[model samples]
Target: MKTLYIVRHAKSSWKYSGIEDIDRPLKKRGIKDAHLMSKFLSKEIARPDVFISSSANRALHTGIIFCENLEYPLANLQINRQLYSFSDGYLVKTVYALDDAFNSAIIFSHDHGINTFVNKFGNTPIAHVSTCGIIGIKFQEKHWKNIKKGKTFMVEFPKNHK
Candidate 1:
């Protein structure tokens, strides 16, 4: 089986208005929530075989925190530039291109795209995935390319921890 872990990037700070959207960093709350969610995931699920994330500042930071909490090496995380935009189709295409050697993978990205992707593939319904939110979908197929619809088995958000 192949599993896809969808992680929405934590809340980013608008304090740096002068900076571009891609450069926005996570706020204090975002940092704390990222750690919390990561801890929650560590206890609730198995570690992902690979980690992929958008190169944007907030997304990358969130991925790094989760990696640290999961005891996964930061050097192993893969970055994709297209993930910075709201492109769910492209995101899925990237997942399809993943090496079949990895059974499970986590993707850290921004919303609209992430939110839409989950609702599309997930069997459960969700209005929106909050900051630091995580949704896991399990596919019956062995290869990433063969994965189409999957059963949504995991849904986690900041409030669940609080």
Candidate 2:
């Protein structure tokens, strides 16, 4: 079985003008939400075998917070530029490329992609995955490449905790 956790990056700051979208860091509220969600999730779930994040500042920062709270090594977190995409196809390709050796993995990414992926690959239909939200899906397949539609057993959002 393979368990995949998809995390939408925490809220990002648009205060800085002229900064590229990829360089937008998390806002103060985003930081707090990341910490809150990570600490909350750490108690609810086991440490994931692998952590993957988009190279974007907000996404990577959110992943780091989760890694720290979950007691997973920061060095082990894989940053994939492809995960920075908003396209569901890119997200699908990225998931399909995951190493089968790891039974469980967490991915930190953007919104439209996150929403699309959960709707496509998970049994549950979520209208939107808010910032700092996490959706956990479990697949019956042993390999990532073979993953079809999976059971969406968990849905966590920052607003829900507050």
Candidate 3:
């Protein structure tokens, strides 16, 4: 079995004028939300063997908060440039390329692709993956390539917690 956790990067700051979207930092609320979500994931979800994140600043920051709160070693994280604003196909390819040594992994990425991937793979009507939200899926197959639509055993959102 394989466990995949798809997490959207937390809210980003618009404080810096003329900053590229990829360089935007997390907003104050984003930081707080990241901490909260990380606490919840650390206490509730099983520890992931691998932490994969987009190279974008916001996504990387979110990954950092999660790793810190969960006590996951920083060395365990891999910053993948392809994950930054990647398409669904790119996301799938990244997942397929994951190291087999890890049975569980977490991905920190942007919207649209994240939402599309989860909705397609999970076979649900997931409209949007809000900032700092998490969508967990369990695949019956051992290999990521074997994963397909409707294979999810569970799905969750931060709003559901509220």
Best by lDDT, which number?
A: 2
Model 3, span 80-140: residue lDDT tens: 9989865777789888888777898999998889988998888567777899888888888
TM-score of each candidate structure, all chains considered together: 0.97, 0.98, 0.93
Minimum summed lDDT over a 10-residue window in model 1 is located at 85-94
lDDT of each: 0.92, 0.95, 0.86
Compared with the true structure, what per-residue lDDT tens digits does model 1 show for residues 1-162? 999999999999999768988999999999999999999999988899999999999999999999999999999999999888786987788789999999999999988898888888879988999999999999999889988789999998999898
| TM-score computed on alpha carbons, candidate 2 | 0.98
Model 3, position 140: C-alpha lDDT score: 81
Per-candidate clashes, comma-separated? 0, 0, 0
Colliding pairs, model 2 = none
Q: Which consecutive 10 residues in model 2 have the weakest lDDT in total?
A: 86-95
How far off is residue 22 in model 1, in Å? 0.3
Q: What is the lDDT for 97 in model 3?
A: 89
RMSD of each: 0.8, 0.6, 1.5
